[model samples]
Target chain A: MALFATCLTDTFYPDTARAVVRLLERLGCTVDFPLGQTCCGQMHFNTGYREQAKPLAQRYAGVFAGYHAVVVPSGSCAGMVREFHPGLVGASPATTMTYELTEFLVDVLGVTDVGAYFPHRVTYHPTCHSLRMLGVGDRPLTLLRAVRGLDLVELPFAETCCGFGGTFAVKNAETSTAMLADKMRCVLDTGAEVVTAGDNSCLMHIGGGLSRVRAGVRPVHLAEILASTEEEPWAAIR
Target chain B: MGSNPVTWLGTPPFPKAAHAALGDSQLRANLRKATGTIRAKRAEAVAELSDWERLRRAGEAIKDDVLSRLDTYLERLERAVTERGGVVHWARDAAEANDTVLRLTREAGADEVVKVKSMATQEIGLNEALAAGGVHAIETDLAELIVQLGHDRPSHILVPAIHRNRAEIRDIFRRQMPSAPPWLSDKPVALTEAARRHLRRKFLSAKVAISGANFAVADTGSIVVVESEGNGRMCLTLPRTLITVMGLEKIVPTWRDLEVFLQLLPRSSTAERMNPYTSVWTGVTPGDGPQRFHLVLLDNGRTNALADPVGRQALRCIRCSACLNVCPVYERTGGQAYGSVYPGPIGAILAPQLVGDMHDAQAASLPYASSLCGACYEVCPVRINIPEVLVHLRAQATAAKGSRGPEALGMAAAGWVFADPKRYEAAQRAGSLARFLARDGWITRLPFPGSRWTASRDVPAPPAESFRMWWRRTRG
Candidate 1:
């Protein structure tokens, strides 16, 4: 088993990568990090640079081909791998092998309770790609419900996009900001101290906004909360 | 149609228009309220149907079937219409459609015509064209009347004056509508009463009526106009001559096919259990309704759209406006920012393709206007893969521009680094040097092109070690 630490999770939020590894290993599965992994080329392909994305996508398929099962922490990248990669990489094993972390936990690993404890009122935002594109329905929630000492609260407009659409946040900054404002409002309404999601791209956008407003709410990746245990509690977000 | 001679407005690209629109707090508030209410209602209406996905698939299949063998159905439609005593006119473009309408209006010997709310007429700038040829086309729909009275372009497909509030409607009526009573109030009921009174005179006396149909049944040659108000009925019946400007893609092969559409449309659109009025007229019926009927079947850029395998799915649109209400982009910027009669998620895909010129800069900007949110696709009754088409169009727009661009160059360079493990690791190692830019572990600002990212939200700084680097050291 191998983990595809998506570009953002690898370079910026390696803590999420480590947490995923810890959680999977704790569930009695050996998780291997494929050294050749770099990116899924989602940014290039989505931004209309299809030609530029081809080699990277091919590289991804080549690197992960040997692994019978590939787990990804970010739902957006997992969706790109499982859904979009087939078209780019020509029906490779990676397409069928790839799994977003939550789906990997509940379906493949066949466990919802990972023996984790996070004593905080947390609201979960279903990232657009995870909700619509991947259709990993209630898997993340099922896991959250099983966590010891975790107070799971419902997010208003949970299905709406957080507007952290890779290049979209930059290309259309104002509209992105406007959408983020609505998402932030919903998060505030939940009265939850922590906001969690399957993708860090959404968390980064949301956490940045929360930090700016001096809002005390913390944005944690789903893996970190799941990795926390009574023996070794997860560290707070930087 | 591809081009609007009278109503083109030489509109600026999407970003510029959206920038201005974002500044208008009132417009934002109005748009937020309207789209929110409509989206909620649509969701509830759709949930009532246990077989919603089945109906959506049927709707898609029906439209796809029509598009695949369009000429056959269109010819059948023409034959059925002609046999029923309705004259059919074929329009290849906006100019042709306008010319046909103007000629028909002149032939009818009437300088004025009453109109039903129609996207086709709006697409062709029919009112401006008719006025240019010394004719007046009075808008009879309540929302259309508000837009006309305000001297404004429609900002929505279903509700043209959705950008304007009740107070603005009152102001427009007081200032522009000559028939408005002096003491007209801003209340919606009052506004509707005023419009009803104003348009009643036009409906009764006008010699001609012009409209766009929701569905044109090929089997019976019956045109359907589904509306909330009885204004569409008045427009279809009272006039001596009725001219319908229909898009070629509106055809449904059989009357039975209309069953799927009847179930899909009203639920997807006004979120009604059933529309208040549905006018189905086949042809001229002497003494019963208009004695003369002209059906102008329009093919403006539709063939061009159909030519692209990925893009032809856009033609499945029933003008339900469900996509608009769910789209975050349309919610923020409103319809005017799209710079075309079609706006929102569907507009982002349809306008560029309908314009059919990838080099057209204004149209090119439409594809990039969205954040590629799949809300539109989820809510669309016809299952038009809007984001898929948007990405497809973006590729075309990129191909036409031909790759000397900076974004293209940057992607190429990144692709190079990512294709090799050593190079990619080095790039990751190089990225960690950006710790200087990090303030409390987040980069708040950056240099040059990277500024686009940091302009709004803070970007994460590269961690101290790449995951590959950490993995190798720990596991080697």
Candidate 2:
């Protein structure tokens, strides 16, 4: 498997990439990174910029053309591809079905545990695109259930926006902060040690709320959770 | 941005103060007091009805059924209205619709036209259009009058000038329109009396009136206009000639559908089980009501919106503005930012669809205007699931243009690696090597789309140790 290690994992949270890779390898699969890959153009595409986003999409289409299946860890980025591909092509085409990770695990690969184990109190934040866009109902949760010693609690208003749209916070700061305050309250209400979600945008927002108040809550990516296994020496192999 | 007249709804001019009152604080207070009170009342009133959910379901189902056969429903509405001695005119777009209304007013031989608070009129810039046609359209509703005299736009649907406070309104009434009585104070009673006197003469003498409909029952050919002020009743019935420009989506299957709407609209809108005035008329009455009636069922890109299955449900919106009141965005920008007469949550989803699926930039900007908070969905009298529609529209809009950016590149790259286990594992090795990139476990300054993320909030630095590294060391 070639890695699309999303820009967030590659540039900021590479450890999530390492976990995702080891989790996959523990399940007996090879991972590869297409070094030429870059960021998904969803940011520019969403902010009412059409002309600025085309070449990045073209670069993506050209670089990953023949791959059997492409998997994205972040639902928002995957949404930009699986959902926005036709928009990228500017026309409906016969070809366009890339998979987000949960989609890959459940639909293509048909596996839950990547030989992972984790012992901790964890709560999952159903990222916007992952829940509504990808419709990954319980796939990540199904994987979470497989881990040994996992204590998972449900977050309240689990469907609400964490108020971290790419530019929404900066553009509408007060409203964004107001929404974030509500989301953090919910995350804290669950009394879980860490918050987990597939999309980084949401985690970043929730984390900010937790950090701003120096609240005892932290957010973890789904990839980081999946990479935890007691049997496999994952990090050394990576 | 404000002058384009093509701006998406809820695109206010002010930033809502990173913590300030407003470049338009008057607008904010007006909206806050109005929306807050309405939202609370709506909750209370809706709670009184155990069947509210069922009613919402019924409304959704009826709207869905009507929209699926929009052509048929519209044709039926047009035919029924025309057969009853009312003239039925088809407007292809706003310009045509404006032209038709102006021509009708001209033919009526009326110099000034009285108006009810109609979104359709504001939707097409009817007052502005009437002015161009050399017609002075007098807004009789106190709020509408405030907006008119103040040279501002209507912010909220139910309360057109909800963006103004009493003092601001008093200032407008005192200065903008000379006809306003000098002693008129901004007190509710004084303002209402002053407006009544100023508009009473216009209502009794005006030969023509222009309005919009809240619901147009196709089966009975009845049109309903709900308002707090009795001005709609006067504008609707007093004039000899009456013209109503109703959107294609405003029709219900039958008068029985009114049972759900009459209950839902007011309480959901003003948080009252019933508003003060509700004017329902089928056609001209022999001795009472307007003698000459014209119903203009305007399409103007609605059919285009109805073509998208996932998006078509947005048409189910009853314009109750329940979604708007509970909406955080609408709570801040106060309808001006939307740049459209429609603002808030409903505007975010509806404007993109109504303006032809974001072929233009303003429409494209509309979808990004929401937090997908789902509060809009929870408060939607019809259960529109606005956030779902927003995501769907965002997809259609992007698909319409075809995007090529770091976001797309990122999805495709991630998509390929996650496809194979070996490659995913190898990528994990690279991940450990790249952990240094995120400093102190957080990445503050970002680039491009990611920068769009860091612009408002701080990104938590990556953990000093990967979960994988920690797990491997502790267990293995």
How do the residues B13-100 of candidate 2 rate in per-residue lDDT, one tens digit apiece?
3333223433356656676677777777788988998898898888888888999888888878877787777889998778889889
True contacts kept of each: 0.58, 0.20
Model 2 TM-score, all chains together: 0.72
lDDT of each: 0.89, 0.74
Candidate 2 residue-wise lDDT at B155: 73
In Å, residue B12's CA in model 2 sits off its true spot by 9.8
Task: Report how far off residue A110 is in candidate 2 (Å).
Answer: 25
Q: Chain B TM per candidate, please?
A: 0.98, 0.90
Q: Which stretches of candidate 2 lie over 4 Å from their true place?
A: A1-161, A165-178, A181-203, A209-238, B1-33, B179-185, B405-440, B464-476
Worst lDDT window (10 residues) for model 1 chain B?
Answer: B1-10
TM-score for each of the candidates: 0.98, 0.72
Model 1: CA > 4 A from native:
A236-238, B1-7
* Interface RMSD score of candidate 1: 1.2
C-alpha positional error of residue B102 in candidate 2 after TM-score superposition, expressed in Å = 1.2
